[model samples]
Target: MGISNILEPIQIGSMTLRNRVLMGSMHVGFEKLEDGVERLAAFYAERARGEVGLIVTGGAAVCQEGGMGDQYCNVYMDEHIEPLRVITAAVHEAEGKIALQLFHAGRYTNQDATGVESVAPSALQAPINRHKPREMNATDIERTIQSFADGAVRAKKAGFDAVEIMGSEGYLINQFLSPVTNKREDEWGGDFTRRARFGVEVSKRVRAAVGPDFPVIFRMSGLDLVPDSTTMEETLQFAVLIEQAGVSALNVGIGWHESKVPTIAMMVPRGAYVWVAQQVKEAVKIPVIASNRINDLRQAEAIIQEGRSDMVSMARPLLADSQIVRKSREGLFDEVNTCIACNQACLDHIFDGKIASCMVNPVVGREKEWALIPAEVSKKVAVVGAGPAGLEAARVLAERGHQVVIFEKQNQVGGQLNYARQVPGKEEFNETLRYYRAQLDKLGVEVRLETAATADSLSDEGFEEVVVATGVIPRRPEIPGVDLPHVVSYDRVFEKQAKVGRRVAIVGAGGIACDLSHLLVQDQVVSPQSAQYLLEYRILDAKAVHHLQQSGRKVYMLRRGKHVGTGLGKTTRWAVLANLKRHGVEMVTQIDYKEITAEGVIIRNQEEEQLVQADTVIIAAGATSNDSLYHALQGSLPVHLIGGAKEAGELDAKRAIYEGAAVGRAI
Candidate 1:
């Protein structure tokens, strides 16, 4: 597909962006110190340097009553102007346009963080955070609108090119717009027009504050994606109203924090929400920006070409690879590190009060700290194992002018990732592998496949430094009859080295166990590969569907913990659990493995012991470090151990990749 349209310049009010691609607002939770502001400046500046047209900064509170506290940026006070100017200046130096997303968290604000009672349209409690908000009175509403105007003035003075009024994602403006949250019979809540009055008034006030020539983008939810929330028609009506309210453009966002829908997960198809943007675009004369799940340049370009939306907005994709736009323009599209839609590090970290980072791009959130600079002196480096850690280490080292070689025991790269990709709905991991392969090739790194390397061997090869990313070995839990012929490890199952019988019992209830259970309960006759092919081609083969539906195997996922799949990411855990439930995979939690026999396995629950029949037993208890080479090479040469070799408690690609990148830069 031609990307000429995507690369074309677009005008939003008085500001003319370099291109149609915009970096949507996403919270990173950088510290509020002076240094933190500098770091934030570097973060956005990096993307600007990568040639993004316009960058919408993470949401900043507009008032003391709606402050997100110290963890997030706040412009409610006059003191914030200078610090924020640092970011705007840096972005401008890179020749990039920037917008400030003015926000009010409302009931989503944590009282513990803000030290103020949260306020909302009504007294209803937020669904996710469960914070009961005080109903906003007429005076409070007027004050909030003025606060938004004050925020706009501050943004304009801080050198921002534009301002975005955040009215989506269950925030204050969204709360008043939705009938579910606004239950008042007052003028601001009785009808759709009344409920929408708050957002319109904020937009009008902000436009007035910034002047008519300045761009004001109103970000509103297209579906809300929650029960009792505004419908699509209502959202379209909102689009028209906000356009009439003096906003220069519209950014169509999907879902809310309280929505039950999976808006950002891998299971959702790419551009699944473009229709929402198209509806709003058709309803309003102003340009519409589509947000959510736009991972590739072609997809973004196609959206615009098809007239679905005027511009494409991306958040996590930029976090994954800030240079996506630059790469696409340079025709290095294959080199772009596409976001895999794994919310493990970004969203999960934000919820846990940590700065958001990317699983694939380790330098994110640490742009200044991890800035890549050419090494003054390059040397020969040996990276053992070609998993996430080793590959990352090699990539960085090679980029810094070092001659790097990677040794893999297997015929191919991607150590545990090869097995991980076999899990249903995790095909996106293949993109990570592809990225590594392309990076290694581009960097001219030597990769020796089916070549196991020992410390002595690496030393004999005259390597200046060695990195041990030997990865991990799956643990075989000790049980009385674990040595039986039918007992196998999860890896063996994925490798097709073990034959699973009609009835299978999996030991452990983590991600691996859940994945194995899902795999085992499927029809043994039809390979997942074939099933995926049929699904991808949209060929509704009834026999294949029937075979999947009538899985003959009975699989039990046993866990010692109180809950199954406790280690799964919050965003993906529900989907995995639901798949297991649909397949009737039994989950036996808080169980102790007594013994295993040919007939079955004896297990003990809280109250009593029972014999669960199983023809085959698979152990997914976890893994232990394969660090024998690291230990053997400890004193021989300068060696660094990363990934599973450093810590084998859990399978975390995020830590592994980050450590690898860190070591790569260090060496």
Candidate 2:
């Protein structure tokens, strides 16, 4: 894992980065807080101190119409410049360069959020957005181009090292470039050349406003991932033109926000979109940044060393581990907390108008508040359970100079994550366990595997405080014939202890059921390497690839509710359900559980009884709190119940980890 090209410094125009890693822009929901700029300053400074090559702030709207919401900073407002200076100054004080991303959401804007109708190249509505944007008149186009230029000028005044024009992800400039969105007959549309003019003009104007010496990076879509969208040839054409327009670098992004493709999900292979960036790199003279799903330094190194792209952009990975670069540079690869791409806390929260945080690293935006200083009085603590909650609590407590011990009944850590890792395409769950194990070891926390500690035992061992994070137990339904040998729990199936038949019926279509269904129906696990090979060489046609994706298994998910996969996050639910449908997994909802028979699951839907044929039945009927330890040790010693032991609503690891860390800090 020795890094070469990734760790090497590279020059983008006048800006010489310390390394080739760019902390890419992400909408972290910090800009709307009362002390938003201060929070952002601390956030960026921490990452800068971690030795990231360069930092790009989340998109700052150039105009009001282009603004994502009030939460996003607008460079058009003069009052915003001084506050943004705090961010650049903080990063500069940490000896790191910061870039301002000038953005225009265009048709992607929510009318309620912006208090204005969205605008696009044409009147075509974005599928994701509710309202159709008004077609831009001649004046609106000219004004928007000017807004970008003005925004760049303000960015320079705010002491930013660079400005990246946000042309990608179906934004204003990208809208004009794509024929699907730009159904216009004006000078801005009709053909590819005309369609590409807006982005080129924006880049040209921004470059002129920023001056020749100032760094100006243009972010463009390498692949639209939408039907009848900009083709690879047209994308390359845009890249070449934008390069000629005087941009210093091109940061290539994949898919629009509205695209059905799961670009940044866990199922997506690491460095999967580097090929798109490579295509752009081949077409342009400027430096190209390979983005989307490039998590670790090893992947970034390979991308740069193999000349796929000049640099790599890792946004969520930085969120998961702020010191990713420092850890990798020191050869402490295992210490690096990798982003699982769950999108549970980050993207899902953002989409829900909640403040974005990290699922793995919960103290992302609260850097100032949750600073882990040494404890005043170290105490001996016993954490029961080695799941996400217990592991995190132990790590934090030990780091704060507390003597900590974790007792896991299982032979290994990652209590429920052990089962989660068994799910197909969810192998990244192992990364979370790996990071926790490394952190626990580094902090000198004693982990007793296969040693179940009773409440009395913990008190007898002289532990002052105990954290009960024993996790949850699967709730078996009250149905007839539940004791059949063919019936199995989801955990048993995940553990490979039960023999699952070809025709399987899953009871309860929650997140776990969906994942189990996916596992049962996945014929073969395609490694990222093999997938890339198949894609690069065109070894499989579209039809053949589609065929290869399916398992052809007969699986039925039975649910008593109206919706399946209800426990999944907003950003991930659709993709998981779509994947299940693609693999031919039948999901039936709003049914009353009749009985679990050896032949199949018998259920009645809409007063119609039906026998769902299956050789094996899996019970994923949700979970209940395993708080027996909490109750037994209520007032014996200082005990805090956390994670599933406290509330097993949906087995949310995000909540568990956060609660664990909070208790650790409190202690």
| Cα TM-score per model | 0.95, 0.97
Task: Estimate the lDDT of model 2.
Answer: 0.91
Could you give candidate 1's per-residue lDDT for residues 1-667 as a string of tens digits? 4689888999999989999999999988875544788888989999998999899999999987687786679888898899889999999999998999999988888877887888999898886775788999999999999999999899999999999999998889998999998999999998899999999999989988889999999999887888878977788888898999899999988888877668888767788998989999999998899989999999999888888999999999999999999999888877999899989889888887777899999888788778888988999999999999999999999999999999998989998888777766677888899999999999999999999998778989999999999888999888999999999998899888999888888888898888787667754565667677777787857676557655589898888888988878877788778878878899988888899999778999976999889999999998999999989998889999999998984668888999999999998
lDDT of 1: 0.88
Which residue runs does candidate 1 get wrong by more than 4 Å?
A: 521-552
Residue 42 of model 1 has an lDDT of 89
For candidate 2, lDDT tens digit of each residue in 1-667? 7897899999999989999999999999888798988999999999999999989999999988889777777898788889899999899999989999999999998878888888989998889888989999999999999999999999999999999999999898999999999999989999999999999999999988888999999889989899999989999988999999999999999999989999999988888888999988888788999999989899889999999999999999999999999999999999999999999999999999888899899999999899998999999999999999999999999999999999999889998888778788898999999999989988999989999889779878999999999999899889998889999999898777898888999998998898899888985556556766787799977566655665657999998999999979998889999989988899999999888887898999999999999999999998999999889988789899999989986668999999989999999
Candidate 2 accuracy as TM-score:
0.97
RMSD of each: 2.5, 2.3
What 10-residue stretch in candidate 1 is worst by lDDT?
519-528
